[model samples]
Target chain A: MVDREKLYQAILTGDAKSARALTEEALKESVDPKELLDKTLIPAMDEVGRLFETNEYFVPELLISARAMKSALELIKPLLAEKGAEPAGRVAIGTVKGDLHDIGKNLVAAMLEGGGFEVVDLGVDVSPEAFVTAAKDKGASIIALSALLTTTMPAMKKVVAALEEAGIRERVKVMIGGAPITQRYADEIGADGYSDNASGAVALARSLAAKVPAAA
Target chain B: MPVSQPTIPRLEEFLFGHARCPVTCGNHLEIGAGTVIPEVNFTLQAIEICPENWADIREQYSLMIEDLCRRAVELEVPGILFEFETLPPMTVNPAWGLEITEILSETIDRFHQSHGLRAALRLTPNDTRDHRRPPRMRSGPFWEGMVEFLHKAPHAGADLLAIESTGGKEVSDEGLMNADLKKVVFALGVLAPRDMEYLWGEILSACEGTDTVPSGDTACGFANTAMVLADRNMLPKVFAAVIRVASVPRDLVAYRVGARGPSKDCAYEGPYLKALAGVPISMEGRTAACAHLSHVGNIAQAVCDCWSNESVQKVRLLSADAPTVSLEQLAYDCRLMNVAGQSREDARKLRDWLVESDSALDPQAYVLRPDVVLRIASEIAREPTPYLQTRRAARAALREINRAFEEGRLRIPDRERRWLERLAKEAEELPDREEDLIAECLPETSRETFLPEEYGLS
Candidate 1:
């Protein structure tokens, strides 16, 4: 049987190949995919999130660790589906249209995945329709938009309006961030939440994805 | 060391690197802030211009500088900080950067002539990332272009040059503060040492006479700080940007480094200073510069703090890149002492000894105490590190750097020395080479997306 301890170690060290092998081994041994994921995978990712929060880990380490987790997930995903395993939640994220920057969006996607959310990374320069469509198709609980330039920031609001037009505004939470973005901007644009960094993005995803109450 | 006279800089001198006009323009200089040093200054930080908005860009850049200059006199701003942004690739050639600088120079002169307002101008780069180019331009070529740009720039009549990091501000669609080096330079830092050695010399050449670039992954402040402080007129003129003293018995200078403020407004001020213990760092008992005040407030306070006591000694760190620039020859007599390592006292001691030593060098690097560093390395060796990557990369670079020092490849300046020579120097070895070190420590993700060419970040 693939040792749970060994699996955790692989993910923690960001050894994607090892993590995948161990995960498959565990599944082959008839370990409950749900139990293994809940016990090992989620917790390992949670630890990565905590390290990120404390500044113990930065963007590079975070990326590698997330990659490791994602690789292992590739192995476990089908089994989880057959066994009817639900993620912490589902999220769709992308850099808004006319904005080509992707580092921030990529980081948030990694963080979201690490936080146990199934992230639909829409890549950079994504149109509002793309975001809404991803959310609609994936049954996503949240849609995250990012913009760095003040000039490009207006695209975020457009996405929000698009969500309304598509009739998905009620279901999907919209979160925004970037250098020029602020909490005030988030409120002005009517986004559900805002986070300055990736770790905060994960927390926002959880709180946003989990049982969000309707506004008064 | 025989004491040299403190050449107090007039408000005009701080404009050298950041803002400049033809030196011959003299009193005819157009837009500028009023002279108020060791006091206070306000900064209108960001400048974003679209390519189509040609006249609009000039108008906006002027209006902002003029408004700030007006405030400089009214609020008594000690210096002027203009973040000349090169957004949407405003310039097609060297002349474009020069033209923009000339216009800003005229703006400063006009303001000075009309409103009776003038302070040393600090032209810092607030470049937005260029999406048109591939990630990571060649550092050598980018810096070569920058050096040529700066040469054309001196004619613009600027007094201070605050060269920013490699990549300027980037606006992401995702709303995350993701700043990264263009990945191309990553190759230069970790892989190509020869190219870095050439690029390092070029950077030092560019920063020769300028002041106020913060130490970051891209800017190595040791030499630049020394260069500006060594200038008799500039140092004393912008004295407020120097160390502020306190009532504490121990020698305490309230010095602030650059940091993303607590509120994260792309602001800088005493927040970084407030994290330190010295009283002068917390000017007006504040934790950060006013968002409205911008970085100007910090410079004003620090300048005044230093000028508060003229006789106090200072220590300025010289770039050890030059063969003659030895640790023993650096400015040890000055009041500004760079204590880089605080949490790690052992590392601090090692740095101290390197600075203090003058005679025969320790080629083994074992000459200075390296116990604390070795121990830290050992402690983190086997474990999975959640340690900050910048800190991790820095520690790794430092280890290699100390080894370089021990191997007799580098030298530190003496307690009293300054690098004053031709603008360009023969290519030399640099242990803590600015651009290379910055490129090396960048997170892999940042390196992949940001382009050095986009920001003119070399």
Candidate 2:
């Protein structure tokens, strides 16, 4: 039997090669893919998030660990799908129009993915219409918007309006985060949620996902 | 006398220099050599289409400036420095940008001539490369637009030139978020200074051609990013404080490349820049609440040469236009500092109050104290290279933070306490040579985000 402990350590330390090798080994030993994911990969990513919140691990660390977890996850994803497994949620994320800043948005997308969500990254300088289109097409339960500039922050409001116009406002939750974004701004813009940091964003997404109704 | 050309031969001269290095601008206004100048930074509520609405856009800015200058005259403020930080659309269209620049510069000139209330216009083009990954610093349309404006704005009557440049921000954004020291070093220490050296060379040539004062650059995109993140509890405050210290050497490159004093107001690291570079630094504190909230509300003003309200929109307020109200608040702040500076003892008293009020509230504010700034700056100046200076600044800040924590002057949660030790160890373990540090961090960096060749890395 494979030493499952090494897989957890590999993911924790962001050793993608070792994480991939170990996950593959665990599977060959007839280990359950769900068991490996629930017991090892998710726990490792959860700990990474915890360390991030505590300031022991920063974005670089979070990014590398997320990479490692994804590497192992890629190997297990097909098998999990064959077994009829489901992701925690589906999320659509993008940086709002006129703001080309993507580092923060990317971090949130990575964190949401690590938290077991199926994320559709919309890239930087995204328009409200594109976000609305993505929500409708991907059947995303949540739309994550980001903006770094005070000038571009208004675009976040335009997105909420677009969602309402698309008649998806009832089903799709909107969460916003960025340097200039505040809880007050989120409340004013009618966003369903706001998270100051990437780690908090994952928890916010999960809670919102729990409250969301199943896709029609 | 206001020096026609300002130059400092070495870093040692700036050790205790404050209000001793001045840059004369327009006809009569002198900043830093002595006395504080109030620089008002204002913007329209929103930018609309150009040519189609250039008339309205021009009128909006004209009214804001007219209101600001009238208030300056009424308040009996000695002088004003107006910074026109162009929004994206303005810079993208150089003709529209120059038209607005001409109007603002001509207006300030008119105000100075009529009221004898000396004023200078600082035109800061919004760095357009912000939208590009692996940024195109020396070439591309954004670069072309920026360079064209640099050459023409001075001729259009812009008296000073500066930028909140975003050269290394691609990696810097990632580094600050993850507490990644090596990435931070590369972004600020290596890439930023190199970009500053090149960009400021262009700025200096422009300044010489048009006789404009080459004002300094700010680590706004780099250090300020760390600060905003820390403020939101996304990163450790100590890391943010250390990043602020680390940014000094990077900002100093502007002076090395011939940028004269009175660096941008929003550069919160202005105090350390003033101490180490001996430049007149403009700083905004509580009054800048119009732009963003900050914890260093009082301490940021302790060593400033020019006081400022970062940027306020020209919207209606209960009492007056937002810019007018901001000017009143800033003018009062400058008046108090000027009155205090009339006597050495009185200045010290006020400086102490400014430091003590916010220093203990957060580590980010703590590092901005003049005494702390000098200590960290002295360590930075001793280093022979920008990379070493950046490393030394980070270590020195961590040292001060540790001492503060140990002495009970600052508080640290258990999580932050552990992080402080880890950061101190990490700072010490970083490669002693810049080459080795670069070699190690290169492979770790994502290639798609930035081009290593742009930074002269093979």
Candidate 3:
């Protein structure tokens, strides 16, 4: 059997090569990929998220660990698909239209993927129509919007309004974050959630993802 | 033997009896000496603009400018500098930017022509080339519109040029998050300075054509991003503090290339630029609370040549419109600084207060001290290139933070202690030479985020 501790350490240390090797080794040993993902991978990312919140880990550490986890996950994804496994959630993320800031949104996307969410990154300067279309077509459970400037912050509201216009507001949860964004602003825009950091964004997505089925 | 005070290298070379503008402008109010110039940065309130709402946008600018200029008069302010940072739509349409600039500059000129209230507009068009990483510098609609807006705004009566350029943000964003000294050094040190050389060259040529003063650039997209993340608890304040110092050399690139200062107020690195380059720097502090909250509210003004309220929207408050309120607040801050500037000893005392009030409270605030600034800046000036300068700056700042923590002069929280140690170790571990550092970091960075050719890397 593959040494699970080594795999965990590989992900934690952002050793993508080691993470991939350990996963392939485990799969060859007939250790269930689902078991490996649920018990080892998810737990490792949860710890990474914990360290991020406590300040023990920062963006680079979080990013590399997420990268490692994704590397390991890529090997398992085909296997998991063969088994008909569902993701923790599906999220569509983007920087609002006219705001081309991508780092924060990318960080959140990475963290969500690490947390086992299937992320559909809409990329920067995404329009309201694009977001509405993603929700209907991609079957995204959550729409995450980001904006770095107060000037383009209104675009977040426009996205929320677009969702309402598309008649999908009830089906899709909306969350917003960025430098100029506040909990008050999120509330004003009728976004379902707000988080100031990426690790917190993952936790927010998970909770919002849990609520999505009930709302539907 | 006692250590001597570290004097800034270029202190004696500042123009206009101090670090004021190198050339004359329509604003008659001299920056850097004699009196403090109050610069106000304001935005429109919650209103979206389309072709149909263009007239409403024009009226909004009129209301904002009229309120601010009238408030400056009512307050009996010495002079004012207005920063019209265009929104996306305005920058996308060059004519729109020019129209707004005409409205603002003409009104400020009217105030000057009538009330003798000296003022100038600093036109900062947003850099919209972020659709691609390692942004296409001088091509595409985004780049063309930005160049057009910047080139024409000055001709339309803008007296100054400035921008918070985002050239290196792609790498630096990850660098900041990872708290990787080498990545930040690559991003701010290598990529940003290269972009500034090209960007500021264009700005200088435009200014030369229009007789406009080429003001300085800010690290708002880089350092300030670190700060806001720290403030939001997404990153450690200690790391953010070190990042702020690391950015000084990058911010200094404009001056090395031919741009003159009074650097932008929001570039919290303004004091370092003032100290290292001996140029006038615009700084924002408590009055800037109208725009963003920060711990450097007091220390940011220590070496300020001009005082500014960062940027407030032209919304209504109980007393008046927000921009007018910002003008009143800024005018008062300038009045106090100008009054203190009268006596050398009194000015020192005021500077001491500005430094003392916040320095020990947070590491971010600690590095803003003039003595601390000179110490780190001195180390940075010894470097041969921006990359080495950035490395030296980060190392020197990390050393200061480490010493302050060891001496108990700066109180660091328990959670931040480990990060401080980690940052110090990481900065210390970087190779001194730029090429070696670049080679080591290149393999680690993804090509998807940054282009090697853009930064002149293999």
**Whose TM-score is greatest here?**
3
Model 3, residue B412: displacement in angstroms? 2.4
Q: What is the DockQ of each candidate?
A: 0.25, 0.34, 0.46
* lDDT (Cα, tens digit) per residue for candidate 1, span B90-131: 332455556666776687677677765543343333212233
lDDT tens string, model 2, B39-76? Answer: 89998764444467678889998999998888999999
**What TM-score does each model's chain B reach against the true chain B?**
0.36, 0.95, 0.94
Clashing pairs in 3: A59-B177, A60-B177, A60-B178
Residue-by-residue lDDT tens digits, candidate 3, B7-55: 3544223211145333345668667756777888888875665688789
True contacts kept of 2: 0.28
Candidate 1 C-alpha lDDT tens digits along A1-216: 568888898878788899999988888888887788789998898887776666455454566788889888887788778878778787888888767566667778888887678888877778899988887787777889988656578789989999999987887889999766899989998999999878888888888876554430
Q: Which parts of model 3 have CA positions greater than 4 angstroms off?
A: A1-31, A54-57, A160-171, A179-197, A211-216, B1-24, B456-458
Cα deviation at B117, candidate 2, in Å, is 2.0
lDDT of 1 at A154: 78
lDDT of 2 by residue, A34-53 (tens): 88988889988999999888
Show where candidate 2 strays beyond 4 Å: A1-72, A84-86, A127-142, A154-175, A179-216, B1-18, B46-56
